[model samples]
Target: MQLILPLILFLVGFGAYEFFETRRAAYKIAHRIHVNGTRGKSSVTRLIGSGLRESGFQTLTKVTGTYPKLVMEDGTEEEIYRRTKANIIEQARMLRYAADRQVDAIVFECMAVQPQFQWIVEHQMVRSTVGVITNTRLDHLGEMGNSLEDITRALCNTIPFNGVVFTSEQKMFPLMEKIAKKRGTQLIYADPETVTDEDLRGFRYVEHRDNVALALAVCQHLGIPREKAMAGLHQTVPDSGALEVFDVDYIPYKRIRFANGFAANDPESTILVYNLVLERFDNGGKRIIVLTIRDDRLERAEQLAEAIVQHMPCDYVLLVGDSTDRVHDVLTALNFPRQQAISMGVASGEEVFEMVLDLTDDRSIVLGIGNMVGKYKSGTQIVNYFRHRSHITPKLEEETRA
Candidate 1:
């Protein structure tokens, strides 16, 4: 009965999508564009939109990354609330809005898993002049499967059959080329070093690599120069809630500090942060003290705790959340020495911060990972206290990795 319900829903949703696509193509389109990938789809969308505007064209862009949206040139914006089947109809509605503005081009983030999925939303989407595939990353394992190869295949859904397709320096482009070949789309390649697009120096110098580079390359192909592209890139505003870094400060600590990597959603990224903290803090002077899982992420809180216990020589473990006791099972299962780990029954960030403050002096480097990966803001409060109240500076390591 449960399966039958979903099937009925799919048929109705698919049928409505097809009808929208057919009505959508009636608008005279100057060109259509689509962008996709794991990390930078939204960033790439903004860059391409900026490039189009610089190239003497009116551009409308929709970014479906961490935030969902509808963006138009006159500087007005609206947030979209979508139902379970994903934002297909909301996307079609955006295209219609763009058409009304007579925008010369449209750039949108592509999240579907197959070419057929692309055909459904895009059949009525703007007539894209180009296609952009930002570099791929290992995410959405349950949906795209575990292997990198599978992730690449899923992202290829955004590449159109006949239009120009541009991909970043992704490791799996050769395989993507084969997919493009079946559709007759020639895969064009781009790199940050090429400096062909626009000067993108003003964008915090941090977010330049991942998806922004891919966007610049696509923008350059649309006829915007390196200088003009840079201007547009700088001129481009981060359409609000668009993955921004807000305050930065520092603290002298024998007590370690965590950047709250909890915002991480998948195991792959969490593992990377684990290695980073372990490698950097293995100085043996002060030990790594981590608040493994935040509140609201108690479901897999034990998994994160387990991973941390195995990979690092943790001085102590502070578990936060209603599921704090679950972590004890893993420690026992692994036979980790009991002297080093403890669950404090879902402590608040204020309590955690106070405990760490009372525990150490000015020599400890606290590594906070998996803060954002979960479903809470405990990490933010900790970081903010150190930043706005204490005023310490941290050398952010993500851009170097990017």
Candidate 2:
């Protein structure tokens, strides 16, 4: 009984200390921007940080994407080394780091998917001055919810109390606004019409118009001029998993164009990426789809398989990554041609590449979708293998956007 009292007292004291320290750290920074949503959180976080820095705010940013990173004030970024699986507590540590640096602003990509964690991250850890939702979509449904409305509600957990929030999600604006009002927050719609194709041409990658427009709106609200903010955005470093294309000569007579859309795992985002890449690079070649499936993301694999059957017209479907048998079965059950769907179970990057070559003719378009990183899948390796073999002219380098 005596020991129990002491243990309880120690636990309570530690909890109180942590709470005070975290809030203190958050208050030390002048501005805090919390970015959440299903699709473009990392891209929007990087954009806002770059623009804030350009406007002379000593900014720091942390993005959990294909490659997790910490973007410093001088626009230099360092990969965030993790010793274990990611946790929400990292936000507290990031805030402490930013407070120590005495930065003028910090933009964080929301890393929590579970609705409860999302609420705790924003209300307890970040307590952001500005919030950004980069468009809610059908993603993390296992953690967020099953429907789009459910996902939007889960994402709105990060909407700052008594502060302003922004989003480019036109369809869900009404629901978002209702939630924002209840929290004493004002929601603003970022009009993508303001961001022109000419502005997009300045990018070194195929950045979506909605992402740029959303980030621009956040920056403008922070008092950065559109001209200056755009200049910074143009110079912004894209996430490692950002949409990129490579045209490679695989053999003496064969050539292939590869587009990396592995990061867009959700059905809506995946379809958009498919349409974008197909529109830009379809050279009348055989359309090939390489879908990488993670063991834990079998549900996503099923979703993508259904979406592909309905939307993405293709000549062949190559299933890679862990537990390929399940996804192949899904494709077969969906009435996808059994012969066309090839299940190369847990294949290496080179093995997948070889299969892609075998499926391709003289000219082909190969689109990679689904999870980028997994215990068994290495989308980075596959992308790098193609990049190393690409002999396209110097003018068409990896830096070339569209």
Candidate 3:
């Protein structure tokens, strides 16, 4: 009992010191923008960071996406190697890194999924002066919640105290506003209409208008001119997992179009991207959807299977990763033609690519969705295979990796 008392006191003192140090680190930066949401958190974080840097602010950005990366002030990125599983404690490192650089601003993609951690990350660790929630979508249901409303509420836990919050979420703007008001913050809607098609043409890769608009809103609020911000955003480097379609010319077969949508973890975003691919490339070709599953993410695979069966129009559904047969069963039960669902259980990326080629004749549009990277289970290998074989220019090859 006597030893426990001293241990408790020591712990309390250590925590107080950490809290003070973290807050001091955060205060050293002129701008602290914390980005959260179901989708596009990494993209938005990168966009804001690039815009700030272009506007002459020494900015640092961190994105916890397909991989954790620390984008430095000069736009060079350093991969953050994780010694263990991801934790909110990593935010402390980000704060220290920013403070050491004496950055003018720091943009962080919120890595917390649990509700309590989300609140603590914002209220305690980051204490961002500006907050951005890309959009609310049905994702991470097991952690956030089942309903979209629940996800929105979980995301709102990142709303800063007495700071402006920005979002492109139309359905739940009111709810976010209510939460922001209680926190003495204002919620601003980032209307996508304001972002012109001309503005999107500057991007070298596929970028959503909603994401661009939201980033623009935050940059504008930071006193950057729209023209300047757009210019910076144009030059912004895409996340390594950003949507990119590559055209591969097989020696024996005709050209194959590979759309890397593996980073779209949620079904809704995947559906939207699939539809966009269909619209963009009207070439008559076999359409294939590769759904990569994880042993731990069977539920997500099931959700994606339903979305693919109901919404996406494709000739073949190639199931990869762990428990593919289970997802194939789910697909069949959803009325997806059994013959069309091919379960490539835990196949190597080369094996999957070979099967995709075997199924296609002349022209084929293949969309790789689901997990980007997993334990010995990743869609990136398949993507890399296509990327190596594709006729994409050296510049494109460089950009995609960035």
Candidate 4:
């Protein structure tokens, strides 16, 4: 009886998945576009969706950012999944749902986890009208083969034969260019830098420039007017937790928050954020760095800690996660101030925040970073709370109007 019941449940799940797959495949044939990259997939997807809407197109976006946010044509936001591994069947299922609702186009972000999945999901399942590859960076050391060749091959496999590829100049750009040409898909660069300061309302970060360029290039190809496309650029805001800074006054000191989640996906990114850390907060008083290294990527743990110490003069360090002791040792060994480093092992995000809060006086800058959002799924909310509290408005309305 136990065996029979288990088999029945398995059959039910399989059948449901198969149903979703078929429906999703049909939806793809109807309105298909695929965007894949190491970073900027979520931001670029959101930017593209917003741009399309400003141009009066019906759009549905399946976002696989640090979290899952699905944006419908009416600009409604729905929380889709809380757990990770948003599989190919699920990606297809979103298309099916979009088709039912009559969304004009479907924008999907491809997961580069098992790089080969890129080809199968995009080519065989939903083949795209427009394909995008952001930039190739060094992250994901465990699942992906160690060599850049392996990473590039897995990513390049998604070049669409029938669609255009809007990509950035990357280390593997030449190879990607070669593949796109061979497939006869026109390939172009997506440089955020192309969008001038006048187009964006307020202050801008360097990262958003390429994303803007990419979306504009793709939107223009679809025959959206270049002027309308340029106008939509005014509404752009930094993706949540991206390296944006805000100013707020709370008692003895004003707070500065660096939204670095976009810059936190990999060790090199983390190092870059730290470099920015040094550059921005030079001689800033009472610096408190609240950071967590994912238990999964312990390989980068030591280097990250060492990098933090080498780059920033963090007055006090609050470490979060199971690998705290190991990461702490790297800094302590370098004489990086043993008395200042504190660990919040296996603590909740709020708890970690409180620990930092207790340590923070009026004159401190709190830099919360690392691959926490992707790993913990709660990163954006926690980071968002800080942004909301410290003058970074949730809506980009004011800035857009500026």
Candidate 5:
């Protein structure tokens, strides 16, 4: 009985100390932006930071998507290696890091999945002046909820008190607005249509218009000129896992075009990128879709399979990773041709590389989607294999044959 009192008091003291420390660190950084959403959080965070730095602010940014990285004011980023697993307490540490550097602004992608942690990250740790939600999509429904309304309500938990919020989510704007009103925050909806083709052409790599629009809205709200902000955005380094395409000549007269869309895990984002790739690439080529499954994400695998079956048209569907059986089952139930669906279960990067070479011919386009990194192969590893194989020119092939 006596030990309980001391334990309770000790915990209370620790909590109080953490709270004050977080507040002190937050006070040192003037402009703090918390980016939270179903998708594009990392891209928007990077864009906003780049835009601010272009406007001459010493900015610090952190992203928890694709991979965790701490971006410095000089545009250099260092991978954040965690001794333990992911924890929301990292945000408090990030606040101290920003304060130590004496940065003018800090932009952070919200890392927490739980509702309480999200609220704590916003109200206690970051206390951001500007909040951005890229969109409300059906993702992490297990943590948030099953319905879109529930997802929106959960995402709105981070709306700053008496601050401003921005989003590209048109369907849930009313819910966001109501939350902003309750919190005394102003909500701004960024229309994706406002970002024209010319504006998109400015980006070095393929990027979604919605993400660009949300980032532009936030930068403009912060008093940055659209032109200057875009200039900085153009210079921003894309995340290593960002969607990209590469062309490879594997042998004489045979070529393969690879589009890396593994980072877009959700069905909606995956389908959107699939359509975009179809529009951008050569229509005459044989289209192949590679879906990598994760054992931990069975629901994701099933959802992606359904999305592909319903919307995406392809000559072949190659399945990889631990959860290939679940995907194969889904495809079978849908009456997809057994021959058209190839399950390369638990294959290494090299094996997958050979399989792709065998499946594709001259004028073939391969779209790699689903999880970026898997147990047997990583997206980077597969991409590298194709790149290295492509280097075997006609002359090299002839030399080998001779």
Candidate 6:
């Protein structure tokens, strides 16, 4: 009985301390924007924070996508290395960090997938003034749910009460509006059509128009002019894993263009970007598709294989990483040509680099997709190898000129 009493007292004291700490940090920041969605949360968080900073507000942004990063007010970013595995409690720590810096605003990407954790992050940790949902897609169905409605409900848990919310989701607007009404928050639909092709041309890298429109709406609501917000977006640094292109002339008399779309794991987004690349770069060369499969993400691999069989055109499909057997089965079932679809199995980045060189001659394009998580020849690692090789060519040319 005596020991139980002390333990209870300790628990009560710890709970009270955490409660007060969260509230104290929340009170320090005036504007907090919580970005939630199945995809594009990191990009939207960066865009909103950039727009706020350009409008003369001190903003701190945290993104838990691709890799975690803490974007500072001056547009520089530091990697957020976690001593332990990811937990929703990181949001609380970010709030405390922002409070310590006395930043004018905070933009945080929702890292939690469970509904209960999402609610805790929204109501307890952030208590954000603005909530942004980029879009709802069929990713993370195991944690969120299996259906689109379930995914919508899971994402809506972050909608702030009596606050402003924005989203570019087209099909789920009615459901989102109902949730906003229940929470006494105003929901605004951000139209991707508002951003024209000309506007998209402003970005340094390839980006979806819908994400830009969603961020623009939030910045406009906060009283920043649209033009200024766009300028800030133009200067914004894309997440490290964002879609990037690299041209490699590693082998003598051989040229290869690698479009790194490993981060877009969903079938819809993946296929869209793949088609975009094919259309934009009509080099009439051999188009090779690389799928970096993750053991835990077999469903994703299957879906991507089906999508590719349905629409995408490629000369070769190289499957790497763990659990690529399932992807191979799907392709075989779909009657994909045996010669065209080859399972390379798990390979190191350097090994894959050599394989890519062997597969292509002076004219070929390699499109990388699927999850970028693995030990040896992960998507990011392969992309980095090609990127580094591509850079060396320029330096060699510069030295030759001198």
Model 5 per-residue lDDT tens digits across residues 281-394: 643677888888888777988998989889988888889888687798898788778888899887766887777778776678888888876555556677667656655445
Off by over 4 Å in 4: 1-31, 81-85, 202-207, 236-240, 243-248, 253-263, 274-283, 310-313, 348-362, 374-381, 392-402
lDDT of each: 0.61, 0.89, 0.88, 0.68, 0.85, 0.86
lDDT of 2 by residue, 285-325 (tens): 98999998888988988999999999998999999888888
Worst 10 residues of 1 by lDDT: 241-250
Of 1 and 2, the candidate ranking higher by lDDT:
2
lDDT of each residue in 322-397, candidate 6, tens digit only: 7777788899899888777888887766777788788886778889999776555488788888788875345433
Model 3 C-alpha lDDT per residue in residues 1-402, reported as the tens digit of each score = 989999999999999999999999988988999999988899999999999999999999999988899999889999998899999989997898889989899999999999999999999989999999998999888898889889999999999888899999999999999999998999999999999978887888888899999999999998999999999999889887888878777865686888889888788888988887777753579999988889988888898999998899889999988998999999988989999999988887788889888998898889999998998646878888888888875654544333
Encode model 4's per-residue lDDT on 1-402: one tens digit a residue. Answer: 879999999999998887667646555444566888776777778778777877887888777765567887877788787455567767666766776777678777785477677777777666788888877766665656687766676777788895689887557888888888889988887776777756654335434556778888888988888788766544544455556654444444544443444346565566566665555543355677766667776766666677677766678887776578887888899898888988667666566556656665654566676654545544554565565556644442343223
TM-scores for every candidate against the unseen true structure:
0.71, 0.96, 0.96, 0.81, 0.94, 0.94
Give per-residue lDDT, candidate 1, residue 109.
82
Candidate 6: pairs in clash: none
Error of 5 at 102 (Å): 0.8
What CA RMSD would candidate 6 show?
A: 3.7
Query: TM-score winner among the candidates?
Result: 2
Count of clashes in candidate 6: 0
RMSD of each: 6.2, 1.7, 2.6, 4.8, 4.8, 3.7
Q: List the residue pairs that clash in candidate 3.
A: none
On TM-score, the stronger of 1 and 3 is 3
Candidate 3: deviation at residue 247, Å?
0.4
Better of 1 and 5 by lDDT: 5
Task: Give the Å shift of residue 330 in candidate 1.
Answer: 4.6
